[model samples]
Target chain A: MWRIAIYETVYIIIYGLYTVFEFICGMFEYVYQTVFFTCHEFLFPSEKRARLKELVSKIKKKPKHLTVLLGPEDAEVTDLANLVIWCLASQIVFISFYDHKGSLKKKEEKLQLEVKKHSGDTAQVIWYTDENSNLENGFKGSKVHVKIITDEDSKMSAATITKLLVESENEDFTIENIHKHFVKQFRFPDPEMGILFGKDYCFYNYPPWQMRLTEFFRFKSAKSITYAQFLNLLVKFSQREQRLGK
Target chain B: MSWVVDNQLTRFQKFCVNVIKCGPIPRHIAIIMDGNRRYAIRNKMGKTEGHTKGFERLAECLLWCRELGVKEVTVYAFSIENFNRTIEEVDTLMSLAKEKFERVFEEKDKIMMEGIKIRVIGNLSLVPEDIRILLAKSVLLTKDNDKSILNIAFSYTARDEIVHSMKTVVEGLESKKIKPADVDADLISYCMYSNQSPDPDILIRTSGEVRLSDFLLWQISQHTQICFTSVLWPDFSIWHLLGCIFKYQRAFPGLKKYADECQSNRKKLNDRITSFLGDIEKKRMEQMEIYAKT
Candidate 1:
């Protein structure tokens, strides 16, 4: 009985200590991230621009298509607009914003306006779902093409695509042809990188079909996403090697 | 000499695990086991030897998971893209897989006693006949075990799984059994190879890789906790798994909230879709029947 009591006591003590340690570490991380974000925010516009440019230069390879997965807390239009402007500055051709609730999609016009305000008059922003958006044109004149997706898009696309295939005269369904249909439906290439802004690491039903090779980077919260952190993700993405099962 | 130390270490590990069991435990876990070749190179061993070590590590991890009360484990054993590797390496991997399956079959009694069901997910037609037969037999042998599930993703890719589900849906539509309106996210999910299990609570990828690498893309929801560690597959230890579980527990409350919200939203969407389909349901069914007859 005494031995069992001693073992239980030891277990409790160790577990308690570990939990406390984890709490302390989490607090430290929160403090560090806040301080880092504030430091970047305090930088002069010119200095920040220079820093962004430097970071972009350091990236040897950049993803042409980027998807941002936003948590409920991070679904602010202004923050998304800032992200779009940053992507435009970095020359990413395609950007997709995914929020599970479709809140961002509802505020698309506001997001577009905010992006345009920061991206300048010369930068053309094309919404992929717009009637004028042509898949073949492929960001020819547009500085960046944006697509705002929600859970509905993923579910609807699958149903719609399946219906199209079933209705079509062709009996054969190959991956190549199915992929073509999806590309046509999406009007954007598959995302090469996915940036998640949330307290937890979850995709929230970000399009499964397009994320086969997407390298995901996570930020603690999307509310105060800094340019430096964004640039760092880009650099990290560039450095990582993808074997694609080779 | 080492047996004594190992026994003592296992006792300590049991104590740790018992304490961990006091918290919220993940019901399902997925793993992307990577970096075998790198581990081999680092240790100056043959690549095959590293793979063997990785398999050993998997056994250890599964034991730990079972002790920790995880009911389902899905492992990325092989990918469809892995067929592009050198012929010799691919051959070795197939043989290794066959040998492992045979061993599992030989230990069927033990597996049955443990109530562990074995499932091989993915495009099985792509594998060789002999290995396919072995996998089928192993799955059959353990099909009745319901306490736990071990999903081995062989010849699998998320895209292919999606495509497979699409093909199934197409077949259903062609047969006039289900109309186009019947197809939805839940339908696609049901047709997926992993339809038997719930979405994983934790996804751990070894070797510091940050990508999903075409593993369970359709099933990963906002509730899943993803952990990427730098440790290679052969070097992965119980501590790493415990750490992952610890993180999951720490984030469980928030994850549960999001999961509940998603579930409710999905229910609402399904209701809306059903209501929307109600108006045109007859016409779609008639059209589907006409198409099927033709």
Candidate 2:
């Protein structure tokens, strides 16, 4: 009778204990999702951390020359900014973001504050997106040299303005932008960037100068993205075979 | 050395001359010869006959790729997903493989003498044992071929290649020589079966599918993708390939493609998180099982 009682007790503890353990796991998952995913909750799951931690081995303090293209804001502009910050923090890679904060002249004037605040002491390109602009107070000393993406003699599309920002004057890259005036500035490239956060095949034509052979990665939506998601993209990217032009 | 020739000339005699002239092209031009089933049903043939016809066309096209200066050519002969077909159909495919490999062996095609290697890519373990042995011997006999590389993607899926690569990386990571952080696109590419060759410069797919259908997913990023609608793959000619190449050459001057930004670390975490709880539906389900059981 004592053995039977002990058996029953043991059985109750084993399976019932498993049930409690499962209950705790469910609670942990709920807490993880609600806190980390829903709120700016700090503790990330191991799977989520796997990609970034994997890249920790390949951090380049100073990689080969880096080219930065400033993009105009639509909806996901801030997302792009966070991405840049994350990219920069991960390595001392070369970066040049934009001077154009908003379209309004006054807002654009005040936009230098965000540039100054975030740029700290980074290389910058404060070139005007248009052929000519009256520059006076707000645009005085943005340490990096400013080069005009479009000249008066050579008009270009608005969508391709950002590509023109690449320092190298690859004619093939610039030719596509000569006449196309796009409004948004950051759209899809020929081969879009893998970590892009935008919809539509329509490239807003930022700097049409630099995009000679850009890989295009399109996102139908960027509303619910997190830093961890960006890392995941890099992980997927690392597995790609970049067979450029045969 | 005129690279541009109009293969669509109305004259049949003109077609013969053009075929003779098309040479010095890329040695290994792989084709995703899709749309056999639909083509067969339209022609009032059953699906099984459709595949046999497709097989015939494939054999014929190899002769064309060979004649026109292509040393090696690959065809997406079967996809892993295609295993979902009826067992009878799969049996028919195995029979076809046996017969085809036997014919290639019996004829002692000059290609074998010239050192053209015949490889069956993708998960061949799923194939029947006998068929696998025949494939093994074909590969072995042609292993030293320097003339051309012929890859048949039987039960192939590109994304699965990536997943397979990731699993391989875990093994590499365990060895401590390959740090997890050192894993990048180039590293992964170098480890793949096709890493020896440059990614196919021109990926030609028949049946007018806009999407790559997971064909050569990792290898192709900036290659010229050619999709044809009117011509069924079996009926495709070497002229068809040349015509598309000419068009690609013309478009080259205008369309610009870019390489990816090389990175060391951490972007993976961000992208992974954003993509899901929604990637690799199979593994995710398994992981969900753990969490659900809890």
Candidate 3:
């Protein structure tokens, strides 16, 4: 009888402990979800989203062309696709991605497909891996036009521009004329701002001509870019006063 | 405890020094000496007093550059826009330039002994005549020294330099000394303010400003790596300068390759232009000979 009584007491204690453990786990899960939701919501603030939408909707001027430099890190193609989708949602008409090395062929193809699937014929996405590509072809309509610039593009641009300037100046060349012709021929627009998503805040030669008056914004890493980060960057860029090399 | 921490920091700095030495060093450096007025305002000091402190800092920076094996240093001393400031400020700056140039002239022997070549690159005609004379004398004194170059851009603006080059090119075209076909980037570069100095490899601007500020705009477009810092000019230290060099080292290989490619491209075009000019000269000489015989 005594042995039976001891077993009953131990069984009660074990059951009580099990109940406490389950309660603790439940509390932890609830806290975890609350923290995650808060962080997620912080990036998607209603006020900031409203400000960005309002600023972009003004139609007061053409949407500013922004170029983003990807660093040496192996950022996923899905992240790039997400960035494009967010940019479209935010009403940024033109976006450019410049990498120092040439774009990965398979990855670029996949990215193009993904972008096409997302935006359909509404967006013109061109992967410019070399100088021979038709650089002056697009930027019509109200669609978002995305251009992927590789190192080869910058090299070719420099070489071709220099050759054209040198050859034409012999005929009738002034700096002003060279610039006008180059702009018209290359269809190059001076980027209003360049966002460098690299570990180190450095320009990896993002086509020197396009960056003459560009205000550069640097971020630590672009591996997992969120929509809130993109809109926040645009908000910050709107507030920056460009002296234009006074 | 503080002494121990200092020792560890010193050891780390030495490690950085060793790492930097293993890489290629920048041969030429350009500095936009900015933020003197801001520094003065922050410190509640007079503007001229801030400038005086800046000069002292420059002297120390020169020694640091020399130690780092930098062959040339260019300082953007005064921009043309500076004249638009209050007359009191302008007069103070001009007097300061005169004093500094006079000192450099007075120490001509020491400058020559160190093989330091000092050149003033700007539209010097705008400067007061006495200061211009002193600048000319200083340049003449240090013309032969080849050890190091100190280019002081006084009364200078990049746009003015480009315009001057264009005018010179036009004059050449009119004189028929050079044909229109021969005008290229190389020829234009040769006509700029710092023609004697190679393009700067590293450009450092203080006071956290990131723009080029119209300083060396054309020359630096090729492959120059820029470093911007928040430290005021007066507080710029050797460590900051070394940190900049380390950043340059990181960028050196890629930039050097690009610069080399550009050089080769220019060389090819220059050669073609040269051969064309030579052929033209040959034809003219043959025509002259025929005319003589006739």
Candidate 4:
């Protein structure tokens, strides 16, 4: 009984010491993180662009397909233009864009011209929601393909697909059939990397049919997006070994 | 630290709580509590100890959610793939689960008093029969409670859930209870393991893991705001949750619009199916009336 009491006392003392030490460490960590985050918020815009550029140049393996999700407020023609230039420079073969409100029609012409001018190599641009053009004419021949996804397109495709499912043979509609319809309707490439340019890490219902296994990277703001951030995201994605839910 | 410092920390936490409560908080939050084993390794403790600490943290987190006014919280407690681990580890986990479930039963009165509803989702058949019984008992005890919900995903995977849902639909069809025209997104969703709760508005994955690991893949991938943190599950704090809420608040407007769009899409599909069903029902009623007259 005495031995047991002595052991318990020693254990209690050690445990108490550990708890106090952890508490002190936690306080220090909290203070350090708060200061660092505050400073970064003020200096991130200017420093991040240069760091991202350096990181991009260091990346040896570039992602084949990259998708960018623009916040409702960040969906500007100029931002898209910068993205196109960065993609062309990095040799990222395919880029897809989705705006929350789906208002890219007014910027299509300017976007196309900007891409043509900035795209040193050949590239094909298609509006996924374009009613006049069929799938055959959409991507006839191009080294790079850019598709602008919109809400209207998704709604139309969803209606047609649901109609097809309802008409199909008894309760046999499965994931494959739904997936096939989505692929045929949207013709989207499976993006290996997805970059979200906003504070929140969300897809915002952007082409939900794809992006099952895409690696997502969140940037603080989309207002002053730099190639470096894009490059950093790519490098980070390349380093990741996606288990794909295995 | 001195009492003054501790008081200041509490004040700061309260301030953050006030700010988070100002905006539209997420109705449902799903968490993938990862990195317990890593925490064990880092802290030089046994794996079981890490899990025990994680459980304690989870209990604290549930109380935090209750205080934060979060209605529903679902946690990825165990994945279907976790069964593939070494026999010893699996045994440990099963026993742990049994103990936790038993504890729930032991605390039935307190749980009831708190209005907590505990639900265990996933295929219970795969669990040890004894643990499964304990789980069911806890769930039964908490069945009437409605203040808050806690969904524990055990031996669960989103694909398995989807497959099970599909099987349910197929069975319904085979029995002639459901027509091909009646099948829609909402119907399929209702058959999922998570049908008991609404789709998570915000998802959190801890331990620096960016992938979903097959948690709620079909439900929340489109519209849910996800926050990934490097903190181990045992180390997760209310401050981390608050930061995530701040992020969610910033993105809520766009997310809400997207959610509205998805709802409208589902509504349109449902409307089409409903009209078809209405026609069929009308014909069936007419035939029944004529037969009755005869």
Off by over 4 Å in 4: A1-54, A105-110, A121-142, A150-186, A207-209, A220-223, A243-246, B1-24, B84-88, B123-131, B162-187, B250-294
Q: What is the C-alpha lDDT of each candidate?
A: 0.79, 0.48, 0.67, 0.71
Task: Please give the lDDT score for candidate 1.
Answer: 0.79
Interface RMSD of 3: 14.1
**Model 3 pairs whose backbones collide:** none
Model 3, span B1-294: residue lDDT tens: 000011223555544444455558788999998878789999999999999888878876776666557989999998876777778888999888878877885666667677888777887767777777777777766767898888999888765676555555555565566676566656666656676678889889898765665577667756777787889999887789877886676566667776786677664446644554454445433543443233
**For model 2, how big is the iRMS in angstroms?**
23.7
CAPRI class assigned to model 4:
incorrect
Task: Return whichever of 2 and 4 wins on TM-score.
Answer: 4
Q: What pairs collide in candidate 1?
A: none
Can you write out model 1's per-residue Cα lDDT over B106-192, one digit (the tens) per residue? Answer: 676677878888887888768887887777777767777898789999999888888887887776676665666667777777667
Error of 3 at B269 (Å): 7.8
TM-score per model over all chains: 0.86, 0.47, 0.67, 0.71
Model 1's chain B yields a TM-score of 0.87
Docking class of 2: incorrect
Score candidate 4 by lDDT: 0.71
lDDT of 4 by residue, A1-246 (tens): 675555456545644675698679867866765686557656786776566667876786766778878765646677788887777677787788877655666678778887777665545544444654323444444555678777644434454455454446435545565567667877766677888776567766555446656777877556655555567677888787754323
Give the TM-score of chain B in candidate 4: 0.87
For candidate 3, what TM-score does chain B get against the true chain B? 0.85
Q: How high is the lDDT of residue B5 in model 3?
A: 10
Q: Taking the candidates in order, what DockQ does each have?
A: 0.50, 0.01, 0.05, 0.15
